[model samples]
Target chain A: MNEVIELLQSHRSIRKFTDQKIPRDLFLELIRAGQSAATSNHVQAYSIIHVRNQANREKIAELAGGQKYIADCSDFLVFCGDMKRPTDSAERAGADVIRGMTEQFLVASVDTALMAQNVVIAAESAGLGICYIGGIRNNPAEISELLKLPEHVFPVFGLCLGYPDQDPNVKPRLPVESILKEDYYREDEAMVDGFDETMRDYYGQRTGGTKDTNWSKQLSPLFNAKLRPHMREFLVKRGFELK
Target chain B: MNEVIELLQSHRSIRKFTDQKIPRDLFLELIRAGQSAATSNHVQAYSIIHVRNQANREKIAELAGGQKYIADCSDFLVFCGDMKRPTDSAERAGADVIRGMTEQFLVASVDTALMAQNVVIAAESAGLGICYIGGIRNNPAEISELLKLPEHVFPVFGLCLGYPDQDPNVKPRLPVESILKEDYYREDEAMVDGFDETMRDYYGQRTGGTKDTNWSKQLSPLFNAKLRPHMREFLVKRGFELK
Candidate 1:
């Protein structure tokens, strides 16, 4: 109904970016808006690392499954879920802090995601385009070593931000009825089956008839291959325990 | 900065709300905005439960650590991280889906948070206020059973939305420097100390000098007390396994 809602609805990830870099002031302002997102119990458990070195950016781009936009974008930031800052600070202040609880992991990850989403909205609204690099988790151990992340902090994702050089259609989503339920969780099998048809049409049209996959079939590569099977060991080694 | 940026920076949690209910269409529109957020691999691993029953809301309010606002708000939405639908769909399509990789848990949780944050922005933009209810995790078992949530679906957080009856001052956040680093993970104890001072002043003013606490001291109850220690078992029981 408003410009803000319109902005939210029109969000589409941009991979190709123009050469113009975001001004330092504007970049910092985006972080400010991100910090304004609500944090659980005011823990604010997150850290954003701005990768400025060209070599590091290139390395990360490859580490994140060859996503070249990470190196090409004006700025690439690694958003990390950090329990270290809060728990360490609390301990130093004389509280016998607990560490490595699963709840802590959940809260920190959720806090980081919430903060980053605000950054995305703020960036998109300011005529900047952004892409979330979930592929970074594919090589979390090496990426963390490269960035010198400490114990109790794991990189959740990377974000690439810049002025868009290309325009793409907004990807269609599952209908609202399929995900939103009243009072209790209900089955939405028929709705999902209908969505498969919708996606088939979307992919066909978007790819000029080259791609012939529906949403369900498209998930085969990710689900059947045991995606990111090493993530548990990595997180535990990074002090999450996830217990 | 534009109005969208201003709105993002001006966010504050509203615990007290007016009795006026949001129109049905507007609420659904907010969900639509939420679905527009980026999902990892287009998994769209989330579900929003609209708890419209009066008694259920009251029970949920108590379950979420006695937050009466859950019962009083125009709507209380439990944002659930759902892997069941996606994995099941993939299996039905003939893929041998791996059930509970830790990365699956991370992606689903992140997707849920990103989606809910979008809904929050849309609600705030529409002149409705929201309070995130992180306390629901305190007793997730009872709450999940109450909502009849199936396996592989876990409640991540709740959102209380309505027209504000009280306009609280925007809560101060840690300076961007504290959370935003350059190239590496850096120590920010000094910045955190400075923010403690800022929060001290904010709380003093907000509570008319009745509460005397800094951010560090305020974290004692949560960290020192081993907040939500049962979450690991609860999540495992709910099929997250987090393995």
Candidate 2:
């Protein structure tokens, strides 16, 4: 395998970080790399908010379910799905643009994720550790207000970037057979069963045999309750009406 | 800049491809690299359907706004955002799993995009070309039936991967200052105006001076009318109620 593929395959989310801060130039380069990601119709409907203020970062950390890494990381960034720019630009170009549509939300969200993945890859290549903070969505409204995000824009997720201070084992994934199908959507109970065992072993080993749960069991909280149920209204209030 | 950054910055969507089929092993490796992408809460809620049947691919091409590249590429894949498997597994593992929620939809969508971006990077590193086909959403219900997608599982986008037979110029993006903000969101009308000119030049040069429109003008159709207005109802019908 080549270095790029190897780098991708050896991926792991880093939580703990050292005291080293990224050089300003390198950080800018990482954002440049992010901007290079494939955008649908070249709309580029995304923005990154660098959270530099200590007070704001701490507030964000609390909002994101107490993910202290947001405060501790050398740099924390909130990636937002933006639709205002394109719509406003189109209106300026003489088009009576519609404000909210389902496709617009999908485009902006997917575009943001694609760009952030490129940033993650670039940071890891430079021997930096990074973690995606989806917890930011737990309180999107507060985070948006804290970052002064305008209407037609919403914070999709946060990312923590810094030098590594702790080494975590690469997390296991579902088996290849479970995820890849030939020509149709096929269900393989055997593959799922096999993967559950693998995850069971992984969780046990990772937590020193103290955690006795498989992937499915771990996903209970996410599925058992209404997960961030306010997101629909929040997104609509942020101007992604999903119309 | 390193090879990864270079590879990312040099990305262009390739629609024309050679007839050489990707070896099965290499194809599997690409998917493996995709799985290495960071997923939300280890949900890994995505599936890739490899459409090898010529008839199905042609039909998909028809469904996707006659993008012939769908049928022409060496391999065509439909990337799906799947909440079914996780919810089912979790329910079976003794959780009273809820069916559809907005957060679930967002997580699955973001997870699928992150994984697909990794596949794109891995493919490009191996000298392969890829084009993301969002047009599949034009007939998502038909496409879902064609692929036999279950409830809580929907195709986000299609990908055409193969050896390139055409070299397209890398598309330009908006200026860094416009997309990156320190501490809070900011707007720069001048940056957008400047980028419109850059895009106008790019389109003119790439199309041999036939295309006269700039980026803002090009986005007119997307916003002037209700583009893909059926997507919201479609997602609801597909069990992503966005509730």
Measured against the true two-chain complex, the DockQ scores of the candidates, in the order shown, are: 0.86, 0.86
State the lDDT of candidate 2 residue by residue for A118-235, as single tens digits.
9999999999999999999888888999999999999999999999998887888888989999999988667878888999899888789999988889999889899999899999
Deviating ranges (above 4 Å) for candidate 2 = none
lDDT of 2 by residue, B101-152 (tens): 9889999999999999999999999999999999999999999999999898
lDDT of 2 at B27: 90
Indicate the residue-level lDDT of B1 in model 1. 83
Q: How close is candidate 2 to the true structure, as a TM-score?
A: 0.99
TM-score of each: 0.99, 0.99
**Interface RMS deviation of candidate 2:** 0.8
Clashing pairs in 2: none
Q: Which tens-of-lDDT digit does each residue in A1-243 have in candidate 1?
A: 888899999999999999999999999989999999999999999999999999999999999989999999999999999999999888878999888888899999999999999999999999999999999998999999999999999999999999999999999999999999999999999999999999999999989999998999988778898778899999999998887
Per residue, candidate 1 scores C-alpha lDDT tens digits across B1-243 of: 888889999999999999999999999999999999999999999999999999999999999889999999999999999999999999889998888778888989999999999999999999999999998998999999999999999999999999999988888898889899999999999998998899889889989999998999888778897679889889888877776
On the 0 to 100 scale, the lDDT of residue A231 in model 1 is 91
Which whole-number lDDT from 0 to 100 does residue A114 have in model 1?
95
